[model samples]
Target: MTETLQSLALSIIELATFIFVFIFLAAIVWLIWAYISDIRQKKQAIRRNFPVIGRFRYFFEHLGEFFRQYFFAMDREELPFNRADRSWVYRSAKNVDNTVAFGSTRNISAAGEILFLNCPFPTLEADAVPPSAITFGEGQARQPYTTSSFFNISGMSYGAISKPAVQALSQGAAKAGIWMNTGEGGLSPFHLEGGADIVFQIGTAKYGVRDDQGQLSESRLRSVAAHEAVKMFEIKLSQGAKPGKGGILPAAKVTQEIADIRGIPVGHASISPNGHPEIKSVDDLLNMVHRVREITGKPTGFKFVLGAYGFLETMLKSIHERGLEFAPDFITIDSADGGTGAAPQSLIDYVGLPIKESLPLVVDKLIEYGLRDRIKVICSGKLITPASVAWALCTGADAIVSARGFMFSLGCIQALQCNKNTCPTGITTHDPDLQNGLDPTNKAERVAQYAQKMVHEVGVIAHSCGVREPRELRRYHAHIVGDNSFSTSLELLFPTRSVKPEYDKRK
Candidate 1:
């Protein structure tokens, strides 16, 4: 009888707890509805008179954005921007659902148009032939590097991006046959994973393998070049996102592991000098390039954001005066619109020339010097779609490098928390808790898959343009929108067929 009474008492207590929980949940739902209704009804009135609350409107508006982005929205239903593009990255990376639906969400009559390859009758399969590797320079100094499929991961430093993210990118690049660039953060073991081919970037800082005085160390550079996977070396003069201003990796994001990899003190932020102290003029830069090339015996290139008021023209003149038969193996032109890990709001919003405008200028300048064939041009900045890449190739760029698009592939929700080290998908975060969720092995395969799909799709586009390969795409292959009608972008930029530089030495 006593045992039965105790059991009864326990059941009663459990029932009361359940009732309380239900009531609490219902109250929360009602309160949320009431608040939303109240705000909607009084928003105009509050805006007119309540000065303090009006100021808070922006905060509330931004807060609503957060809720809509992470919680309230569905995977297939984000407005103005949806998850379809990112979903394609994830699907391609996993080698799943590589199919095209009947209709596009895009409006055909929109002002800004997206072009597609209308494969006349039948669709083409992925190309079987391997991309030919380009050999830069002549004789013993020559080095060969192959162009993998359409996709290649752009430079993001070990310090700027987490170790696991680096490891995953490295492993993925190896698996995909694409190359990876070591963005000015210096070399770390994470870059070695899966034995991916690497392009070691020497930035303004010259952080890794520096001399005692923190200058570019020839011996150290040679040692790095000797590594089998380090196929190329690039001199970074400036990046697209924030030209002139150097790269910065914040101290708060720098974990102990990052500190050791970059060889910096744990508490201080890693600051790159605005320009290379050793290289001041064009001649100095060329000489530095010669030394690096002579020491490494590998393909040497330079990356920059172009803003020289005839500085390129001057540089071309200097090359001729010096009797330098060859120029850089390749040149990466980053447009002003490119994304960065973090940057000043002013710089991000209003600095540098957009790629659409800058690409034609740089290409024309190089051609004017009669150096177009000798030097390859790689374009970066805002290449998000098949149409964009197609347009870039059509504009005289040898290749295109994508950054944010790949991050989307890694499932970045664009939480905009990359600088804070709180990226949701583990692509940019340093926190152990968040990173543990990103499985390198799985994510690496996804990277490979996405690369292959992008390449395949690009190949299809190439075929429709009546071109056998991507390299054949030229300015005339595409058209652009004008105020009145549609005309080729090339025609608009080059009014005449013989658009030579005003001061072409060849003339």
Candidate 2:
């Protein structure tokens, strides 16, 4: 009887334990289902008012937007963008206070610290230069229009940016007295709307006006140059995004209107040739530059990113041989760190030299060749901040051009969704609904305001450095940190005089 009682007690304990476990698991399952149901209900509520779907549209629309924005998104930003960046752009463009409430979302003691230089005795304000009406290469024969703005938009094709966006940029730039870069997409009617000075860029593909054999057509070139607003022309050797790679505009964005303006087919993937088909050698490039200069009667320049190749020396030699008259009017150096609408990760992260290293070498090379005075150098690629711009000015750049910063001024949220068609701020997108959100009139005014503010701040920085003009900025103004820390490159790089004129050999 004792043995039987012990067996019954063990059986009862085992059964009771099993029952308890089973009840606990069921409760957990019930909670999980309830949580999932709540999420679905919230999504349904958010998407309910979407077009073409009734109440059911709410559940599916947000679901669709989520899928499209997250999974199906072709690396673009969707609606309900990040609050921090977008808010700053909106406020800056509108000339409103960019001060945020409470403390910054940043960790002050973090590893990457941005140190601002405090002035012991800040100077009083001076009469500011108006944004509009300036000239570069004034004493030189080949001069381009220069505005006083520290920030100006970079080259982006018309098809890449919507008509309204282009119109707004043109109007804004005009009001601010800054210039607009008519990207390789070709000059369009909207580019003329605001009468902004234009920098006509000729890409490797020669899209605007190519002959039947895909050669540069003189008539098309003349037609564009004939426009009174065409202030200068830029031969795009390569961009910062993919210095050696060609341009790629997807077929979806290539609408019939775009095709008509760009003189290309509507359905095909428009890929610019990797190099200029007509330009095979350095001489060919200089000849083309002169040809454009002669045709347009304006400054002609080329944009390129340096890749430690010996060809630059050879190219400079050719320029020397060709004589000063045949040399390009200007050279725009793009750093590897430059922004792009879209690019391969490998090229962006790895290719080309950084501005810090490349700028000094190129400047030294020019100084060595005694050509520094002849050719104006415009530095691009990550020249957005005041410090960076000041560094460029001190190092040797004649002017600065900014693409991404201007986009920020135009309200780019930096969602890093540029290549996709669904940009919410209507900056990089082409969708009608998205584009409508960007009021060109208001946005244009904001562009001017932001340009003025940034320029003014830069001027303030220049004054603090004891320099009245941007050209007065010197390498002593900056400090670099890396393997070597706390020293300026001016003290390190150029121990000799400003113009070398002896190391001009081609090897």
Candidate 3:
């Protein structure tokens, strides 16, 4: 027995030694190959100079973004959205208690900080009323749209986000009684599945409503308008993220379904024209609007990011010359800092006006031109939080829309992989394995909760300001922090311009 045991132990030891030797040889072979490859590579200077050792730099650099988000960054320090803002959205979506234990981490005295003026005698709960319903294209379109939802889900194309993400947003928007914009990708069946009011966007590409030659097809326009849920049509002159550019869907994301819906070829990168080819001048724009409204019998509007002020004045003047009936039902002003699936870094960072400067400018211009009552102003660009929504109402926006805000409700971690096909949370990716992480039914509930809570919190702000409802909020109800760390009334900074008496008389 002793002799047999010794022989077995020796055999086991020999097996272990052989395995280790094989692994060591394999490691050496891999290292030698990698070293040779790195030395020969001309694309990366660090790899060429340092060989295998420099490869770690790229790996470490990729890891740094994750490390900074989880550890090094402060609650209020992150860009696009800070940890505090994301945390609030998460809690709100989860329908959990979102109250902070101690003081706020926000820099209250920072320039551009918004401060609401609380009334000594705030509006009592007994006196507070729900937001009044605002109707679009009243007495004009055969089927006008009227909704009281103050905060709504903005345009996020089906192709830009995953199938489940669109499903969840549509379901949630229905439950929350808010409208969903079917972005520029066009209307898919998922958009209709939830029974929510839909706003079909007409991109420069013309997408779902385009003919075989990529021109606007009247038959397709009639078909889309035929859907009862499609409440309005928005002509996307330009999105905020790429003001002078167009929508870009990578070939990898352009699956058959998305391609069919967008009227583009499968597995091809879908890039829209920079601007509407047919609609060149302001007159052409109004003509297009009239054409769409006549065909669809729905509220028709155009969305654009503000840059040159002269065109706006020309557009408004032309509206007067033509008729109020020729004017757009709404004007959607997109902010410079808006989010998108893909855009050039230069356009995203430096091209257009941020919401802070642009919203008030557009609102005041509308009032000055006596079109404030005629044209409903819907502003979008990072107005995710309740305070920001309230500020927009005060600044004269009839409604506020958010895209990334809803994405957070759908469990986006801001991995910044939107342009890529590897979104970790499955909100922006088309990968079936990644998309499995998102259950449309479950995430839909979270979406509803986020929208409901946002509207509730904005109401809280409105009540605190002694207003009966959100729309009652005026510019004087809020203050903006100045460079001196002192605050000035928003009403003073952007003084309310009087409507021209001639146009006011027409109203």
Which has the greatest TM-score? 3
lDDT of 3 by residue, 1-507 (tens): 999999999999999999999999999999999999998889999999999999999999999988999999999998789999999999999999989877989999999999999999999999999999999999778899999998999999998999999999999999999999999999999999999999999999999999999999999999999999999999999988899998999999999999999988999999999999999999999999989999999999999998987898898999999998889999999999997589999999999999989999988888888988889999999888999999999999999999999999999998999999999999889999999999999999999999999989999999999999999999999999999999999999999999888768556
The model with the greater lDDT, 2 or 3, is 3
* Reference-based TM-score, model 1: 0.83
Over 4 Å off, model 1:
1-62, 67-84, 98-102, 108-132, 138-142, 146-150, 485-492, 495-507
Q: Over the full model, what C-alpha lDDT does candidate 1 score relative to the true structure?
A: 0.73
- TM-scores of the candidates are 0.83, 0.76, 0.96
For each of the candidates, give the backbone clash count: 1, 5, 0
Highest lDDT among the candidates is held by which one?
3
Which ten-residue region of model 2 has the weakest summed lDDT? 73-82
Residue 289 CA displacement from its true place in model 1, Å: 1.7
Ranking of candidates on lDDT, top first: 3, 1, 2
Whole-model lDDT values for every prediction: 0.73, 0.72, 0.94
Clashing pairs in 1: 93-446
Please give, for residues 1-507, the per-residue lDDT of candidate 2 as tens digits.
999999999999999999999999998897666556655564554333332233455568556744664566442133323344345556767888855677777433443222234346544456333333345434433445565554567888887777878888889999987788887888888888998888888998887866777778888888888888888889999888888888877776788888887778886767888899778888888888888777666788898898865777787778777777677778888889885576788988899987766777777777767777677787888666565676777677777787776777777755566777777888777788899988889878987877676676667776676555555566665444433334334645554245543534333
